[model samples]
Target: MKEVPASGAFRQLEPGPIVLVTTSYRGKPNIMTMGFHMMIQHAPPLIGCVIGPWDHSYSALRATGECVIAIPTIDLAETVVDIGNCSGDTVDKFERFGLTQQPAGSVAAPLIKECLANIECRVVDVVEHHSLFILEAERLWIDNDHREWRTLHHRGDGVFAADGNVLDLCDRMVKWRHFPR
Candidate 1:
């Protein structure tokens, strides 16, 4: 085995999926690519995401206290990268990318129709020092027709992976059937 540099090694620890976060504030809707989000809990569905203070959508999210987390399939990989490269502060990403906006049931943030799944989240708490926002999923919309919808997972730099393999360990593990969904 070979050794690698320790700089920015945190990215290797947990390279999570890249999701498009949509924020709508004062009649303006914006979309931003986010890779620093994770599921914090199952019951009442909690998600923890990191959004820098300087991000354009951060102000809207912090002010409105809501946003939509859209999971995009591999087909939109290029568009996702493009969206991430640019800033919503200067560009109208939704119009530029031709993404359809669908109104969410619970949150003010509009959902991206092109994505595989859209999760409506309301800010539950925020850790100011860490730029960590804890959100509770108020609504979840998934494209059930596409069972094989592959999504991109950012592996630092410009590299991304289409989640392809499925390894089930249900049989070997104890099933918690009583858990609330």
Candidate 2:
């Protein structure tokens, strides 16, 4: 894979294809599709996400320091794209989309009940970089029941991939083009 310089101008390095992250402050709920997020460490298990300060939820996330990372399936591609394209400041996305916001453990931010897997998060660090706000959230609560499901993965150019047929990797490693078995 070609690596892009991190310091270069913001260009779609690669469509991150992560599930949507939701947050709420004082009963006001907000949701946004995020791709540049992942597990950064394992000792205590940490997650890092990036959000533009210009976004409405940025201030709420910074102020409340809490959020819920909702894992969406490929079926929700349209809604996920919609959430990303629009602004939560002017719209009540939850109500508009008829999404159910349910209670969570670690943070006051409600999790999307419709999503299969939900992880409650508490922001532990905030780093200001240019116009973006980097959030490091500790995974507080995880509601995972690994039912037969397909997760949404961004394929760039406005496309998503859900869990497809299982490729049995029970052998530990699949045949690789570069690495010899």
Using lDDT, give the best candidate's number: 1
Candidate 2 local lDDT, residue 111: 79
CA displacement after TM-score superposition, residue 2 of candidate 1 (Å): 5.2
Best by TM-score: 1
Question: Candidate 1 deviates by what RMSD?
Answer: 1.8
- The stretch of ten residues in a row with the least summed lDDT in candidate 2 is 8-17
Per-residue lDDT of model 2, residues 1-181, tens digit only: 7877776523354344467778886778899888767566654556778888888878888889888888877667788888889888899999887888888866788878778778777777776773333344544444466443677767664676677787877476555443432
Candidate 2 versus truth, CA RMSD in Å, comes to 5.7
Which residue pairs in candidate 2 collide?
A: 17-154
- For candidate 1, the 10 contiguous residues with the lowest summed lDDT are 172-181
Number of colliding residue pairs in model 1 = 0
Clashes of each: 0, 1
lDDT by residue (tens digit), candidate 1, 1-181: 6788887676775567799999998888999999998899988899999999988889989999999999999889899999988888899899999999999998878998889999999999999999999999988999888655888889877789888887886665567756653
